[model samples]
Target: MKLVKHWIEKIFATITEGIVGALDVFFSSLQKWFGVGSMPYIFVLPNLLIFGVFILFPMLLNFVYAFTGGTDFFPNRRPWVGTANFTRLFECQNFLVPNSCSEDLFWRAVFNTAGYVVAQVTVMVAMSLITALILNRSIKGQAFFRSVFFYPVMLSPIVVALIWKWILQENGLLNAIILSLGFDKMPFLVDANWARFWVVIISVWALMGFYTLILLAGLQSIPADLYEAAKIDGANAWQSFSKITLPLLMPTMLVVLVLSLIRAVQVFDIVFAFTGGGPGTATLYMVQYIYNNGFASPTKQYGLSASSSLVMAGALIVLTMIQLYVRREDV
Candidate 1:
C-alpha cells in the first residue's frame, strides 16, 4: 500500500509540474509574438469566447425576440412590433388587483413571487444565521450535527420537493400523524394561503443548510479577540454578537442575501415538482409563468416570455445595484 501511494504521489507531482511548465512556455510564446500587453487577452480569449457564445449570444437573442411577436420558430421571420410586448405586459387597469390587470396571471405570478422572496429570504437568512451561530459553538458532535443539517442541501431540488410533497399530501405522513393525534388534517397543498406557506417553508428547509455554511464561514473568520474584549468590558452575548459579529459578518451576509434573492427569483423546480402551480395558481411564480407562456401554453407566446425575462433581468440588476450600494455604505 505504501509503495503504491509513493508511486501515485510521484506521478501526480510529475503531471502537475509538466502542466505548469507547458503553461509557462505557452505564455512566454504569446508574449514573444503578441507583445506583453496582449498576453492577458490571449489567456482570457477562451473564456471570453465561451461567454460570448453561450451567455451574451442568448441574451441578445432574447432581447431581440422581445421586440418581435409571433408563434413562428424562425426569429427573423417574426414581424417586429417594438415595445408592444412590454406595453402589454405592463397593461394594467389596477396594478394592485391582479384580477383587474390585462395579463392577470402574469400579475398574479409577480405578486406571488414578490411575497415568496420576502418570506423565503427572511426565514432563510434568520434560520441560517441562528443555526450557524449554534453550530459554531463548542458543542459535542458538532460535525455530526453539521452533516445532518447539510444533508438536505446535497439532495437534488426535485428530490427535495418530492419528499416534502409526500410528507405534506392529504393522505401522507403529516396528515396521518395529525389524524392519529385527533386533529383535523391540514390542507397543505390545497388551499392558496397554505400552499404558499408550505412552498416557502419547504424552500427554506431545502436551502437553509447552504446559507448556514456561508454564515458559518463568516463566523469562523471573525476574530475571537473581539468577543474576548467585549467580555472583559462586561458586555453580554447579545451585545458582543450585535456589535462585533453582525457588523463583521455584513459582507458575507450581503453575499448570502444577493445569492438567496437570485435563487428565490429563479425558484421553479421545487414548486413545479410539488404543486405544478396548482390550487388555482397559488404557487405560480415568475419563472414558472415564463415557462408556461413560452413553452407549456398552447399558444406559446415566445415574445411575451422574452419580454418578461427582460423585465425580470432588469429587476435583478436593480436589486444587485441596491445591495452593492448598501455594501459600500456599510463598509
Candidate 2:
C-alpha cells in the first residue's frame, strides 16, 4: 500500500510540474511578443470573453427585446414599439388595487413579490440571528445541532419544496397528525392564505441555515476579550451582546440582509414546485410572472417578459442603492 501511494504521489507531482512548465513557457513567449503591459488583459481575456458572450450580450439583447413588439425570437424580425410594454405594465386605474390594473396579473405579481420580500427577509434575518446566537453558545452536542440545522440548506430547492408540499397537503403527514389530535383537516395548498403562509414558512426553513452559518462565522470572528472586559465591567449578558456582539456583527448582518433581500425578490423555484403559483396566484412572484409571459404562456409575449424583467432589475438596483446609502450614512 505504501509503495503504491509513493508511486501515485510521484506521478501526480510529475504531471503537475510538466503542466506548470508548459504554461510558463507559453505565457513567457506571449509576454515577450505582447509586452508586459498587456499581460494582465491577456490573462483576463478568456474570462472577459465568457462574460461578454454569456452575460453581457444576453443582457443587451434583453434590453432590445424589451423595447420591441416581439412575438418573434429573432431581434431583426421584432418590430420596435418603444415603451409600450412599460406603459401597459404601469396602466392602472388604482395602483393600490391590482384588479383595477390593465395588466392585473403583473400588478398582482408585483404586490405579492413586495410582500414576500418584506416577510421573508425579516423572518430570515431574525431566525438566522437567533440560531447563530444559540449555536455560538457553550452547549452539549453543539456540532451535532449545528449540522442538523444546516442540513436543510444542503437540500435542493425543488426537493425541499416537494418534501414540505407532501407534509402540508391534505391527507398527508400534517393532516394525519391533525386528525389524530381530533381536529378537522385544513386546506394548506388549496387556499390562498394558507398557501402564501406555507410558502413563506417553507422558504425560511430551507434557507435560514445558510444565513445562520454566515452569522455564526461573524460571531466567531468577534474577539472574546471584548466580552470578558464587558463582564469585568459588571455588564449583563444583554449589555455585553448589544455593546460587543452586535456592533462587530453589523457588517456581516448587512451582507445577510442584502443577500436575503435579493434572494427573496427572486424567489420562484420553491414556490413554483410547491404551489405552482396556484390558489389564484397567491404565491405568484416576479420571476414566475416573467417565466409565464416569456415561455409558459400560450402567447409567449417575450417583449412583455423582457420589459417585466427590466422593471424587476430596476427594483433590485433601487434596493441596493438604498442599502448602500444607509450603510454610508452609518459610516
User: Which lDDT values do the candidates have, in the order given?
Assistant: 0.91, 0.93
Per residue, candidate 2 scores C-alpha lDDT tens digits across 1-331 of: 9999999999999999999998998999999999999999998999999999999999999999999996998899999999999999999999999999889999999999999999889999999999999999999999999998999999998999989988888989999999999999999989998898889999999999999998999999999999888999999999998889999999889988998998899999999999989898898999999999988999889989999999999989987886786577557
Model 1 residue pairs with clashes: none
Stretches of candidate 1 off by over 4 Å are 1-43, 323-331
- Give per-residue CA lDDT, model 1, range 1-331, as digits (tens): 9999999999999999999998997788879998988878997899999999999999999988899998886798999999999999899888999988778888999999999999999999999999999999999999999998898998888998899988999999999999999999999989999999999999999989999998999899999998998999999989998999999998889889888998898889989998999889899999999999998999989999999989999888987886787667556
- Give the Å error, residue 175, model 1: 0.7
On lDDT, the candidate that comes out on top is: 2
Superposition error at 282 for model 1 (Å): 0.6
RMSD of each: 3.7, 3.6
